[model samples]
Target: MSAPPRVPRTRPEPVAPDPAVPEPAVPEPTLSELAVSEPAAAEALDAHEEHAWSRCDPWSAALRSGRGPLYLHREDGTRHPLDIERWCAAPDAADRTVIERCRGSVLDIGCGPGRFLVALAERRLTALGIDANPHAVARAVRAGGGALCRSVFAPLPGTGSWHTALLVDGNIGIGGDPPRLLRRTAELVRPGGTLLVETAAHALDERLSVRVGDGRGVHGTAFPWARLGSTALLRHAEETGAWAKAGEWEAGGRRFVALRRA
Candidate 1:
């Protein structure tokens, strides 16, 4: 397995366009703009699609889908229909309440553009977000939020230190290594901390097994991402003896299960 460390340590350059691909008009979107302006999000996503079609990482462009937490690059130097908020997990009022109940600093894994962190911050919680994709992290940082351009499975600056950890967007299977990923997430959060792992309560087959390609693509198994439903995930939580189910909720089209120390 050539899986790179999931620690938030490695620094990579943000994705840019190739000469073969002409840049499309994708003006950056502010968090507020993205939050309320669905039309703008839709437009930006279309531009991303265009960029992918232009051969920016051609293989990934071929794998590009208009859905998921992925942002694609098209041939016209534009990105595609971006799924700002994915289908299964939604950071709605329920998630907001759970975040408010957090005891200390919070860590949001797979924080894309820091939208969730920004929302968490509004509630006066110290939150941090990390992602493997430099572009996403950079966007979050540029938008004035605390986001790291690194992987979640890698060593964290402050390990076993946070009171709350977020693993929404079916992050339990990050890097397609479920057990290691769960253990690593546990290591990052304090013993009594809560790791809010979200997935499809009904369609979980896609969340358990991941199949990432290269260092720049994503293709998880078709499982619905039910970390809560998996016996292995349950075992991982028990073996750690650090977390137990604390909170859970469902909205839009997903389910969330928050695990904390017993």
Candidate 2:
């Protein structure tokens, strides 16, 4: 009887995969890749000097009292008073003179609270300030200036396109290596661009491990810093291969040197 009328056979429904199971794993990063991926962590480890600038309100005495007696202690057992007030103030006559020399787009390295940047903007110049401290950058932006929170050693915007790079307010001490710093600055500016640098009034060239200390026996970690005089800066300019001493001037009892790329 045709097997009692062929029973209709139906195919079984396809089983759906489990949703909770994870997809195939991604290969973990190698050691070198890990190091490269987390560059900010490495930078944070070496940024001991940033403690003061990162945490303290260097502008207001009421705020500074909480982070008191900040001074730069040198390896040679000397100390230099860090004048936070002056750095936070408006550009003085000397600073204005330096600003006048800025011909085109300006990059102010270590631009503390950005008084210079504000001044340049007021004059309708294309200017940008960079500082390692977020607080400083915020203050600058709040004051209607353009600023970025970054170290000069870090990759910057518009490298080799800037017409002027400033190392004012003793920022030449960055990394405590003047020749290296000058070389880097040369790379940042276009050919024939200018670098306006502030130098120590005295004829001294020093590389020191410096730490900030509060008079109340509290101190931050130490980092390399440098101090150079006009003569020493000129020598450094010669060593940097592309820089030449263009001129020198004095402002507000501070000495500055102008270097032009050859």
Candidate 3:
């Protein structure tokens, strides 16, 4: 009888539900997906160590003296001198020639310090310069030119709409893949648009993984780069099927090729 009474008085306690587990975080947008303008996006990706040459202060003595000790250490154990002075200097006769060739909306790939871009702007041409080096971009902006710290391989503002595209300052060696770079330029330039590229004077086509060095201790990370002569550039253009040789010229001991869409 007492057990029965106790059971009747007893009541079960309520149990609390476990807090719901939070869902996994969503992944951030990629560089392409951001769809941001070149300048803004470029600033986000800017890294000083990635492009040591942009910082001209450390190399001021060498750059100003036109005797830069900067070099590119190739995989073959050879060191190729990099012309930091020319790149940092104002536009010369040869640079003017390249600028004169630029017509309609111009897109300068690897536009170091924006010398050509500034010239284009002075002429009132719709021009945009893109470089991966923030310091270079800053210099360009300071000079009152439109420039962005961005890579040519990244998403651009006017893909396939640019009337003229440039790959000067040995930028044809970019990424160490001439064919790929040519194909990319083709994609960037519209039908009948022109692609002006600078090449080595010799007839060699070589690709090497290299790093930038000041010969004083400062060095950058290794990157793939190529050096193609006029002949090799023409061959690459033919293989791409997106371009045809329009003209060729030499300036300041450097060679250049002009290609137009088929």
Candidate 4:
């Protein structure tokens, strides 16, 4: 038989890229191909902080692309459509089950546009979202959803907060420092609280790191800016001493883990 599949030996560590190998030049994407690709993930932030460009710029092109499904927090401050509505609207038994199991307040880390928060609010559960983008926060508020304008690594606005916090859409990348990211998340979660994380496709180094910027910007093996993967996520949980276990959803091509403070 061919060699057995390579199980992860240990969590993959992302060392900084060497200075000798210049960061690749990511070409500005085509403004014309908005229909072909899905949008990339972005934590909400304010307008001025975001770049002003259209289809020609890497960020805007990627945002407008149909490459990956997305929930847009429009630059115009109006509620744009979100591709995640299908799932967020009709949470499967697995997700509903998790919701039913949750106790006390809830928070959605990197809560983009308050989609989850609004859904949870409908369920009559107390919920909030915290994202790095001020523009996103404003849109969320305008959308009549509640969320915080802050980065994941920053301290939460309130203490001894919620019993359950979510990190969905491969959002485990809270600054490319998984261990510290986990520790901070755990701290934000109160005693007996649980952190529910949704992970990206596995064997992360290549498939996940293909973020093409202007080619002049920094390229990272792990996301110091955006989403991240399972290895770094699990490793961070371990390092932070959070009791953790992963649940793989093979049919959906995703995996999620729940970690609780021990």
Candidate 5:
């Protein structure tokens, strides 16, 4: 018999905060401890237990320069351009839709450069942004928004109590496993709280091993990522049984889905 196919290994990026500037303190949970019920996921995570920072240097360069010619280069050679400029800019129409829908305390997961955090603060809403890139966190702080260098799977402050958790800008693909991410988000949100996720405009449910590339041939560390459209997202949410679809809409060519925690 043929050997089983190897599962793609993806270790969480653990970026240390800049020593020049202090960041808020939050306890971190071991990667080994998450999703223990899912043996395959746990095994995959454990496989890379000692890997260091996810070499986001190429991505860091783009954020530091406040622009992008960056793209996600898949193993198959398909490249998806990343909107670094928009993420560095002020919130646009689609972002406004998300900002307006936010309530109570908010957690911006994988918040790149903190545009949404700043927007939320401008409205006087309590918010915090967490990212696994030290550069992104530093940029966010410089932009006058609260941010921490951390992963979503790590233990965060006020776990199980946030009013809203955001997975915008294709962040839902962070772990390359949508169902696992959905389940983790459910742990972070309060009962009946909401999860606002951005999805692809068309039907798409794909997992890819990719690296951040400058489009000039430079690439960063390879990581597993996934993408989901509204249909795929709804299906995963139902399967998790931890979320119920509350609403779905499109603005500025971006699709969003609102999920109420069950």
Candidate 6:
């Protein structure tokens, strides 16, 4: 018989908030409220203070279990499975390609569980993993990688000095505004530094409100996300005037683009 999949022997302890991204003084709606609230109302929450990103939300639970029956349910009734298995596993061939191309101090935005950070550390490379999910950050640290429970829009260490910034694993869709995210990333990367992005497999460019849902029909807060193909990503980069496409390639059926800060 095949060996059973390994599971965590114990529950992860609560993680402390990273000092780098302090909580705001204002009160905010709970994540549960955001789940049933209008998307427009949830959108009003500060990017740095989105409860779904910080609390023990569905994403965090899935990460803790090292598996998933998770899906991103779009407002239009479309659903996309989040590949939690692949995310929790070691870096695959496609991930390796990105790792090889990384240069200088690396910043991994929305780095869930720090698989890349672990891989980068194996190569003795300087890298830091940042995520809003506290559980994911704890997992990354326990796996012997450096991570911070912080959001990209919040204050971060080494602003405008990171040699490379990464947006992979569908993180390009973060906040549902590709152009604005691209522009913000430019501000984080040093002049002439690089931004490596992974795009969708096929031709696609869209922005939509989505929620984290499980097979049991439970749903979490709604948040904005975007999907972009290489063409669309390049176009956004061009429009921002902060990056130029250095190259594009495909591996393991995934497409990626490398952009140099202009």
Question: Against the true structure, whose lDDT is highest?
Answer: 5
Kindly indicate the candidate among 4 and 6 with the higher lDDT: 6
Candidate 4: C-alpha RMSD to true structure equals: 18.7
Looking at candidate 2, what is the lDDT of residue 165? 92
lDDT of 3 by residue, 1-262 (tens): 1110100111112222213312213221122322234443323333422333333343333433445778888767788888777777789888888888876667888876667876776665667777665556665666665665667776676777777899998889876789998998898887888999989889989987777778876666676779999999999899999999999999888888999976
lDDT of each: 0.50, 0.67, 0.69, 0.48, 0.76, 0.75
TM-score of 3: 0.76
- In model 3, the clashing pairs are none
Worst ten in a row by lDDT for model 4:
3-12
Off by over 4 Å in 2: 1-69
Measured by TM-score, how close is model 2 to the native structure?
Answer: 0.76
TM per prediction: 0.58, 0.76, 0.76, 0.57, 0.81, 0.81
Regions of candidate 1 where Cα sits further than 4 Å from its true position: 1-82, 85-91, 94-98, 203-232
Q: What is the model-wide C-alpha lDDT for candidate 2?
A: 0.67
lDDT of 5 by residue, 1-262 (tens): 2212222222222223224322223332232332122222122232222121235567878978988899998898999999999999999988999998987667899898999988887776667777666667668877867665567776566688777899999998987889989999999988878899999989999987888899888887788889999999999999999999999999999999999999
Steric collisions counted per model: 40, 0, 0, 14, 0, 0
70, model 2: CA deviation in Å? 2.9
Error of 5 at 148 (Å): 1.0
